[model samples]
Target: MEGMDKEPWFFKDLSRLDAIRMLLAPGNTKGSFLIRESESNKGSYTLSVRDLDNNAGDTVKHYKIRNMDKGGFYITARIAFNSLSELVKHYSREADGLCTTLIKPCQTRIPQKPWWQDEWEIPRESLKLERRLGGGAVWRGIYNNHTKVAIKNLKVGTMSTSAFLAEANLMKNLQHPRLVRLYAVVTQEPIYIVTEFMANGSLVDFLKTNERRQHDHKHPHRHGISGKAQTLWLREWRLLKRGITSTGTCGRPTSWCLRTSSARSPTSASLASSRTTSTRREKVLNSPIKWTAPEAINYGTFSIKSDVWSFGILLTETVTYGRIPYPGMTNPEVIQNLERGYRMPRPDDCPEELYSIMNLCWQEAPEKRPTFEYLRSVLEDFFTAQKQQYQTQPC
Candidate 1:
């Protein structure tokens, strides 16, 4: 019974089901174990170990430690230990009649940081909205009257301020280099989000503009970006898309493209612009049927896997230069077609490799979908293999 009072691994009140969940976590191994007070029997304990073989009675085997009327503990009839600590120590050394010997203590979870680390609030006076960027709530504004920025205004219901800020804090932490950097938030009557300005606008708009230029014939190649540059731009977005999907989040349509020195690429303040009480958020969450996964539309369930289905839609958008998905199909027909396994054909200029990735994303079963991390690595290798083609027209 050494240092029984100081073992943080001893979780006195954790339930049986929660112990199973922790032990079966992806990070856990076969022998990971914990001792918990038995729910049905007061003053007794249960030893839970993860043993994943089907031969074992259960994936997580639980053995009851019967507390003798005298001050001692025992699991098997032949073995008796004077203390709970001694019983645990003895069992760690050998499985004896139990399922498996304990290898490590159940991992103690680190408490999530409960508050925002840095201040995010800004005074309204610091941002100057110069002009409307589109016909929307966003405006081309100057932060501190000097730094050009895009400002988005969101109306908050009086009751939802805390929820809005909590979501904002999460967005601040997950800001990837590929995303539009969120500058400051104004917590006034109409909340304002200030983000770094992108002169060209969303990837959808930028790509459409170029697509039109190519179709015009007179200005067939006047988009000012080389073919190699466009390829690199899309490559960067594949990286960014992975980061976005890792968060398991979806947001309002953003001015996703940043006009890079070489070409137009996607970057977003979409995370910052998800204002919970606002009407815009309502529209975004109720995504058009074409953009939503079948599971999402049918069962109203969303997970990272569902987002993968949407990423397939985004892939089509990228390949076709932002053409509306399932063109000419009504929402009802779109859902019907999706249920019948109707996947979009590869766009005219999309490479076979890219189309294959889209197919992976559109897997009918959620568990069948590949993760964003897998997608990112695949794309990196794909681009590397094609590296020589872009070398001549270096951007």
Candidate 2:
């Protein structure tokens, strides 16, 4: 860490007991944390944090920060970072794992602000509901009698307020052309989330409508695909592949969104994403089972590597035009086949390169799967060349 960055309290030689004592000292609170080189291991580091809220044990706790053999670092297998600074920054923002988030270095006192700021909270009276956007919780609305906005109303009792928008830090830091712009939050009996309105409607409807038109017209290429598989053609899949990783939008394993034409840049696998690590490999607990990787389902081991596996599913869903993955298979059957090294075959008319990429994503061993970074680069090269062949975005 000294050779890397942020060394005000790196403590290269600090012992485990010293770390616990420093974290438990007089003024420290939960989330007060420090990183010290491990005394037991030559080059490894340990994260020590105070957790006064835990009634089970002593106030201070320790976690190991391990280095990935290939590259990056991780506190848990589910999440990884390119550097120690990013690892620190991520946990500081959200305690995705760990006893608590890394608030300030072990001793530094920094005033914390409420996750929701008073300024970001808008009054309900200012919003005028126009019409339902389609279904679900969203609607077209007028904000302050002038601005047209997309409004999403959520029931307060259904989920905790902290659970929904706890990532104020993540939200504030997000600024991208491809992502929908959230305007403000209305905290009332029903929580209203206001965002920029897209005049064309959701991407799903747009794409579906176009697909229906193309199908009705009897486009020759339609013969290759089956059912209502209307979302993507090979050309269109090539166009959207890069945009897939750049946005925070959910993929097929979770939720997929509509696009507004402004696509995104290629980056790490949205696989540079959120995840869970578990020990029960044979059975999946709470996650969407179909999209999960074998390592995660059987052993509870999750990482960006597992995310790569999910990305393969995301890719299949994309190319198949929103078709459910493992088309004819049940969840039990899918899991059984996956355990036997079964990967979905290439979709009809799917390019070999695209399927090859999917195969890389589907590799059974978590460590063997291509990373989001690698996938981003490969997709960019492959799709860019294909896009140049057509010279147009998806219709």
Pick by TM-score: which candidate is best?
Answer: 1
Q: Write the per-residue lDDT of candidate 2 for residues 1-395, one digit (tens) a residue.
A: 43754555576676775565456433356788888887888788888877744222225677888989988889899888898888888998888868788888766333234546444566789899999865456789998888778877764454456544643223333322233445667655577767667654543232344554465244433321211111222222222222222122321211223222111221223223325332332224334567777765665555667766766776665455456678888777888898788888889767787789889988877778875667766676665566564455466
RMSD of each candidate relative to the true structure: 17.2, 18.0
Q: Clash pairs of candidate 2? A: 203-258, 203-259, 278-300, 281-297, 281-298, 281-299, 282-298
Candidate models: Cα lDDT each: 0.59, 0.58
lDDT of 1: 0.59
Model 2 deviation from native, Cα RMSD in Å: 18.0
In model 2, where do residues sit more than 4 Å from their true spots?
A: 1-115, 130-135, 156-158, 167-169, 198-206, 211-287, 391-395
Q: Residues 1-395, candidate 1, lDDT per residue (tens digit)?
A: 34654664476677876676556533356788888888898677888888856322125778898877777888876979888778778878998888788888876444333454235566788888899975656699987767778776764432256654554544444332234556667766677766656655665565567544454334222221222222343454442232222112211132132221101111123323444435433433444557677765665556678767766776676556568888898777787788798988888866787778889989999999987667666766666655544454545
TM-score of each: 0.52, 0.51
Best by lDDT: 1
For model 1, the run of ten residues with the poorest summed lDDT: 259-268
Lowest lDDT block of 10, candidate 2: 226-235
